[model samples]
Target: MRSSTIRRALAAASTVSMLALSVSACSEDTANDSTVDFGYIGDYNGVSLLAIAKKLGLWKEVGLTAKVKAFNDGPIQVQALRAGNLDFGYIGPGAMWLPASGKAKVVAVNTLAYADRVIAQPGITSMKDLKGKKVGVPEGTSGDMALNLALEKAGMTAKDVQKVPMAPATIVSAFSSGRIDGAGIWYPLIDTIKAKVPDLEEVASTRETDSSFPTAFVAGNKVKPELTSKVIKVLQKANDWRARHPREAITESARMLELDESKVKADAANVETLPTADLVAKTKDGTVDKWLNVLGDFFVRNGQLESAPDPSSYYTGDLYTKAYAK
Candidate 1:
């Protein structure tokens, strides 16, 4: 296989990775007086909320300790949450299906207006250009969602192109070495690919078809609403701090997540972190619900789901309101 810095990092890591702050415990059901088992994506696509929460001591301020674990992607994180291995998880677009499919409950929106894009070589300027080309994307991810939607918009489908299912990190070397004609992935690594393939061009993005692509925090069906509320509260505090100290937030997140600070900064460039107050307002005004519906439809049409479930069944916007109200 082709190799690069990111490829090496991802290959060296596993789905059940532990965060730097994670405490090794024998039992998965370790929720107790103060500690909660939390999971977040170990990839760069993940927002730094959990990392920030740990770095700024917001967890202690909120009177809780998080036993954080890192997973390779949203789907794996959701799997852990569903199996009761996690009290909570930070997830991407998979939130649309996980909750509706009776796997988890989305408690709050973490980041909004973020994107997963299809980046291609110079010659592949449009989605249609990829009709017979090999496209690399970690299947069952937000990136896969974007690629399918973009293909549909261009009057094509996944069958029209060769789909190479690889982890996000591997896409770097795959695209750079011309092993794949294009890649559907998110940033930080997108920037990394650009540096390797100077003529790299983003042909499609989630923002094109969906107004907003939001990442969220999820909990199992049995998790108490109170605990989720407290977690969201701490996340809100960290989001507030992150907005005020953007550079420091990136550096601190890099330190906490064991990623390069420069790459983290580049990846965060287009990510828009909404305040808890704003998320509550959006939920009240039905904007968030609409986003969820759009996301659900995307999955259904992509054949990932039998049908789209009602937004209310999965999204609990009241949780955001309640958390921010505190």
Candidate 2:
């Protein structure tokens, strides 16, 4: 990730940034169609194939000149996708509503291996203690999901607290200054904040429910349609390289987030990167289908979507099949 991009890792979530997937001329093929405008969340967990593909020069060899942008939040990325300013995106549950709402599609997915953790201020020791306190979370992101889960585990909900909306990168500042009492976020960013305040301690992690939160690489419904298959091929090649060179993959991902190697390595172990064929099989056999249903139901119950569409319709394995053709 670019240092400038990493610097804003915690920008607050924006309510103004709707998915806005209205048909626009922006998702059209550009003059230089070989270039793919890929925007991804800079969170290290989502860095798996994109950063490695760049480091290995895999995308270029696969006939793509990627124009990468790192956004601090996913909804904003959807905003760009809506305007046709982006071709491909790696988004998390925070923005999965796009695909679930027929605005985009999931071309690939990442394992729920990397779950989120909660860091509490010294005075607040456990999830139960967060009642009525001000807590920071970027709304709709995985961190928020984890926070909600943890709160429920403690017999509370969003209604029980003053939910301060802010990016994980910015949470530490507020926390130390006493603006917020705790923060729920992903690994490195959570760790980054902890480094600044050693007295703060970890209280809860969403490991028990990690399997329910798979990360997805989504494409706008009308994205550079022709290159979608090519993009998936390169992603597969990158993941193959990662399995063969686990340490190197971890190191490369760490470099992108500018985080400690061990932190990335620890998180990497939890995230199971699935192969294309298996993901395709799962997608078709209702394994992936069931997961999407659960997610859509959760989002709707939580008031994110009005009605859930057929989750299976949002993905297709045809590209994966053709990508491996003889």
TM-score each candidate: 0.87, 0.84
Show the lowest summed lDDT stretch of 10 residues, model 2. Answer: 14-23
The total of clashing pairs for model 1 equals 0
Off by over 4 Å in 2: 1-32, 257-260
lDDT of 2 by residue, 1-326 (tens): 00023322433221222122111223234455667777766545567677788787776565557777777656666777778988887776656766787777788775554457777889778887887888898776777777876776777778988888886566757876767888777664654566667788677876755346677777877865567887888777887777778899888877765666776676676566666667767766778777777778777866778977787678655665567552
The whole-model lDDT of each prediction reads 0.72, 0.67
Candidate 2 lDDT for residue 187? 60
Best by lDDT, which number? 1
Q: What is the C-alpha lDDT profile of model 1 across 204-288, one tens digit per residue?
A: 9876653677878788888887777777788788888877887888877677656778766665765777766677889999998
